[model samples]
Target chain A: MPSDGITAVKQLFTRLVYSLGRETATRELKWMKQALIASHSPTLAAMLQRRLSGEPLQYILGTTPFGPLDLLTRPPTLIPRPETEDWTLRLADMLTPTPVRPLTVLDLCTGTGCIPLLLCHLWPPGSTRAYGVDISQHAIRLAADNAARCNIPSFQPAPYSQNVFIPVLGDLRDPDVFKRLLPPFDIITANPPYIPKREYDKLPVSVKNYEDPAALLGDPPDSEEQDGLTFYRLISKILRQKGMLRDGSIVALEVGRAQADAVEGILQQSAGLRNTQVWKDPWNVKRVVLARA
Target chain B: MSSPEDIARARQLKELEPLHEAWSNWTHARQSLEETLPLMQDPDPTMRTLASEEFTSLTHTLSTHISTTFPSLLVPPSSTRDLHALLELKAGVGGSEAALFLLDLLRVYVRYAGSVGWRTSIIQSSETESGGMRDAILEIKGEGAYDALRWESGVHRVQRVPATESSGRTHTSTVAVIVLPLSEDAESMSGNDELFKMEDVKVEVMRARGAGGQHVNKTESAVRLTHTPTGITVSMQDERSQHQNKRRAFQVLRARLMDVKLSQDIANRRATRRNLVRTADRSEKIRTYNYAQDRVTDHRIGLSLMNLTSFLEGDGVQDFLDALRRNWQEEVMEDVVGESE
Candidate 1:
């Protein structure tokens, strides 16, 4: 029997609620129904049923809130975890009190425009301007869509509603990106892909099977076999360029929990780097490093 | 039916039971050798290497157990103190590697303290300001902390190509540790108060400067107090308020006084020809972490654990510390029994 859209959604929603429990299930079902209503498509019912069978709601709903902005959750762009959001908020707070005029911020490996869009919305105009750079075109498109979805006033064309929010499409490993967007930034932050490639394949279905493989597993091994710290080393190199950062500029990053000492060693070896301090996550894991360049 | 030797052996074994596990690793290799007796004549170099390695390990363990268990063993202090003791360096002479081995010793102690629910704060640290720490004074506070950390007073040497080295050649450095017991009360440990007097103390207030927030700056709150008579100094920069610093300084002064009095009491007892307990030597290389091989070996009781990375990351360290402590207690008891006999 071909069930009606309302009846079908209610049934699927109840099943989802049973599987994921009341809170998550209810939220996901609401998002599904809203998406269905907005599109006015019957296929949304089948998709909601697919989600009830344990498909991640981030993929099903097609978007997730990161900081103050909603980001498109799609292929080649990793879904922003709650820990990442917490770190983003923390970095935002750290960069807020700068006395310098027009605070410039850079978000490296910025997937789906999450960090930049959130900063653009949350930051006061004229005080701060943020740029997000990512290698994946798919990711950049998702990021662009996210910025549009968040209605980033700065990126809007003519009567520029806000001061500055630019999403530059560039590879972090490439020197060209730094040459082009080589503005003096007060803060450089990234939740760079840090999980070892060997460990990525063993991740649970929630991450491995669903998330973009490229976003999760980055560049291949170098001579030293240091894979995860690739993005960090590259960023450090680019930031060392003239006029890119002021003396004692903060470079904060979210890294793998156990890599604190190793990363500290890296910063120590960095030419212009001065210090590396570890900050614990709410779980007491050594999660963030605030390295200065 | 039990003979005198049987009874003595039984007592010795009982005394060693708590500690024997730390030194009994030879049994595993001996058992493996027995199993591989069929392959004793094997011509393969790989098999020969494996067998020889196991055999050498077993022999090393056997020799250590024999020396420690000997009835007339000297049983010197494992740490350095104000007291005098005979010194001997029988083995271990790898230059820079030996020094690096010493650095590993300090790291183990630090990690062990962390495992025991104690708060170890770096009160004062003079860093190489390049890659490694030069000398760091850690103030550990917890129940029984003084007694536990008392064993850690020693000279540590480290040998490694510092992470900042471009040439990737090893360098050697040495650090000395002095672990003073922050005794609960001076009168309890010394039974007297001749060594420390308030009149002998010289108090000084100075500005604290380090890596904290506005507390490190905008204040003249840091306190540095020195005992003029004893030449002993204690700094109280942990706290922000002047009153707190004074209180902390006084507490440290009291602890140092207690330590002095206790040492003096021990000296007096020895002069009267009384038995003094053996203390661990601080100069001894207690533990070594060979990063290249990913192995950590405690040289005292000859115990080696292969999982170096996980151990340093602060997991399952309590198990090792507990085993070592129990062994040390048993070793102490064995010496007492030998004396009584």
Candidate 2:
């Protein structure tokens, strides 16, 4: 029996697992062993080596379940985080008690269309139409594929109806493109790039190297003191435009660590927007900002 | 006398009662305006301002009644108003140019459906060799899909330089659009099994054509059905299974039958009415898309607007639909008023 080879591989994986912290190491180790057993390929051993070198677990698995959806996870597009999943479910719960009307939702920086897809799944079909916009073409394509794959019920009656999820390729950085968007949306949600420039370097090698730079960083930090708030500013400005934000509509945004206050300030400064509030994540950090128009 | 015609006439008058009430409200507001005009010259400045404001408010109310409430009263209740629509687009003439325009027209509707939250799916399509669509059938499913898209049926002419053309000279191409309301009883009709006599139908199975590769060609998955009485043949090869193809072929056949029945009813109604509404004529060129001028001209209502690109992308088509509905209501009102007289 080649006991040395199995023990050596387990030891290497244990070191890699330890890097993720003791709390997650056991689970990650078990998952890696299960994956290895399932594939039983030498190539998977190479993948394990890559994972040991700090490749994101999502990329290694190729998929992650967000709410009721199994979303395809690929490199370059930001992986669906647990923080996002928590807030999205909370948002859905908030809207579930409301009267059913033809509601329109717009999601900015819709990485994997996770927000819109999950919302559409949670909301009653035919009453909600959700649009997801991302700057990256790859994200847009992947999001569209996910939308098609999910097969969410659309308001369209039988014979010709399709999924209500629409993925648009657009850069929120451009005010002109933002202005061109059709308005009167009932809800707007965003999980934009909010990681500060200084924080990017401090991020684990897995996130810094494997994840998309566009997904993690906002407009180049103007100064050392400036935090990532480029998307929040642009979104707020666009929302302030005449006929952009509908009366009594809600805008929910996922914020970075300790950035909720700044995001709330941005929303409060925007015309017609009020009742800014910050929501804490499961870990008790203020991770989301909610505002009403 | 209480004859059937008299009963119908009385019922119609009762239906018009709401319009009469709106007219009376307008008249009352106008009377108030007349009364306020004299009060505007009152000795007190506050009274004058009050009278002027009253006059402005009354005038606004009167206009709103005429534009919205009055027109809404004129629209005859339609049974097929809530039904989904089957919109078919086919290249009429100008060869590949027409095909290209047909494709663009299809995109316009699809994008428009997306914006409005309506769902659209291509039922069948025959593609031209040049990557243009020769014919396409779309099923637009949503609440009031038929009502919104009913006026879209007609010949749509486009004036643009063809991609195949060497010169920049503008060429005209025509695409015919036919809109039919999907039967509300589609499920029951399909399930009845006895709706169409078996002896009068011919069914054939063949290899599926187009993009499916070796597996598609190897198996006889395509199904074609021909109605012996009407000589209408429908072939569906999109599905991998012959059963699915057969089912789809039957669906198309049923829709066609329903369309024929509805058109006959429309024709009979048209024959009875002396004043013909030219807008309903499918042969008429209802709209013109001029790329050179960046304009879309709807010939029926004389609506010509710039921003052809946006219009083609399904952004401004709602305005056109609204205008068409308004025109239709006005025409129906005229017919009702004439009949009452």
Candidate 3:
């Protein structure tokens, strides 16, 4: 029987081997040998202890790569993952400026504001107005900071648009959050917390200890009815209400393991979305589920 | 009368194939011209005309080979012969003028590489405020890149009236160009144990702390490899990824470590070093580019070439390279003959 109880990850190799490439593995280990010779700061033993104890390197370094941008990350907000980046790129590929209209995007639970910021960076500076909505102020602040840090250069022929990425702090549970959003979006991308309460305890210490629990857990905190699909159900309800999504626009969301079918069904039945599709990540697991309104 | 040791030593001695081919071609053409001399005296008018044409052509061929072809056994057999080259140029005397000349020297190399169909990339370049390069490393990757540019190691002095000067007084500025051989597979360089020890070097990276997977956001890694023993530090941040920076740093480190090792080896073998034409000293001025006389002169061989404009533009420089190479080979042959005596 698998010990960690995670459905997706193959436990064939140790987590450490799965985590870093051989070059980086050796590079990190090199500091140990280096410490013996030079007595440098962040010595081998200290780095090993920090890593072995399940602290994130990015959190320690305070910066992470999001597409072309370098984003500042903290423990309060979820760090951007490679899987998220993969699906985001796939999502970005689906969107293009109509001959007449500019592309507008709204990214929910935008930890590090990586999604909207990446879309902004990929798009012409004035071609996009991406809004990143997260309940946590820390997430919104970090996302806003990343927007300034990236400062993507715009090429000519792209008409100027105001504020490419706007970090909005709004709770998903509240009905009033939709009032803050700019309507008629071309794309609505979300990487919401989808892990059920029962599955949360089984997560690796690296994730459970370092990252925010609210960002990973699908259930609302301290609520009696703790369904894993709280955010997804709310997003569908929000979609059903007119003014958020325009014609031909989509709501593409990153999902947890084995939840793509469940999320797709919810979007189709409740949100009045048709042609819902499930996209697989590199690991061959369906990681993102999308539906067109 | 030749033993196995003698044969092996001869094989290891020099890269003389091109020189040997030139000599053989020159001698064969001379022999053919001698044969045609008698044919020119024949009674048949057509035969005489054909023979005279053949003699003239053969004489021209022999003269071209003598004047332009690399002299016999000039280039020493080197591990560098099969490798690529990293041309490092640093501005030496006369401040900004030296820096500008360095830029000109870099352009000349890039242009030369372009003409020869060799690929050149400016690996590390820092430009001066006066529209010049302070120091730069141009990577030339092609067959015979190192061999063609190996003799271009020492100081190249440029005599020109400064564009920045108020009065037109010729100022002597220098640009030091060092050509170092680089292996195609960078692993061979970093893997070598004799030149540098893995233990002596300390690789300083942003200590990648994390649970070791997708859970941590990967950084834009910057690597700095320090030789703890020599205090030689190579910091690389130009590459997008950390792994590439480390690999690039290791390659440069390998080249520099080899430089240090070879310098020590040459110093230890002072007796044997006297016979070689190329000195290890990079500080000494080897070539002088005189704008006043429109001449480019190689100080070592006492050879002067006219049309300095075309030379700086990378056309006429080949003539000097060929001449110096031939002269170097002649000197080695003399030393070898003297040893046999």
RMSD of each: 27.5, 25.6, 19.2
TM-scores of chain A, one for each prediction: 0.83, 0.87, 0.82
lDDT of 1 by residue, B1-341 (tens): 99999998996786566455544555665676676665655799788777777767667666765655442233443332222111111113443344344345446656776676766655443222132443444556665666555544554334456565689876554445566666344213122255565667766655322211101112223467688877988766543234445566666666666667667766675566454455557676665555566666666667777877766665545555556665765665565675678
Where is the poorest 10-residue window by lDDT in model 3 chain A? A4-13
DockQ of each: 0.01, 0.01, 0.07
Of candidate 1 chain A, the 10-residue stretch with the lowest lDDT total is: A154-163
lDDT (tens digit, per residue) of candidate 3 on A1-293: 13324332223113434566544444444333433355334434445546656677666555656555667888768988756766776776677654246787888898898888877776644567777889898897787777778874222233465336778888876878767665877789888888778877777776788888889888877766565778898889888887878788888898877788989988999998978989876445678898887
**Taking candidate 3, what TM-score does its chain B reach relative to the real chain B?**
0.76
Tell me the tens digit of each residue's lDDT in model 2 across A1-293.
15337666667756766775533454454455555676555444455577778787767766666756777878878888756776897898788522246677889989899998988887765657778888899898889777767876422332222237777788775666655456777899998888777667767677778878888886565544447888788788778877767777899988887788888988888644668888976446688899888
Best of the two (1, 2) by lDDT: 2
Residue runs of model 1 more than 4 Å from their true location after superposition: A1-23, A42-44, A52-54, A97-100, A153-161, A218-227, B1-341
Residue-level lDDT of model 1, residues A1-293, one tens digit each, is 14556687668777766776654454455456666776665466787776755455667666665644556788547877645655666666666633245567788888776666666666665565678888778777787777677776436342323646567788776767866665777778777777767666656555666666656654465536645667667766776678888876777777775766767667667635767798864335577788876
In model 1, the Cα lDDT at residue A12 comes to 75
Task: Give the winner by TM-score.
Answer: 3
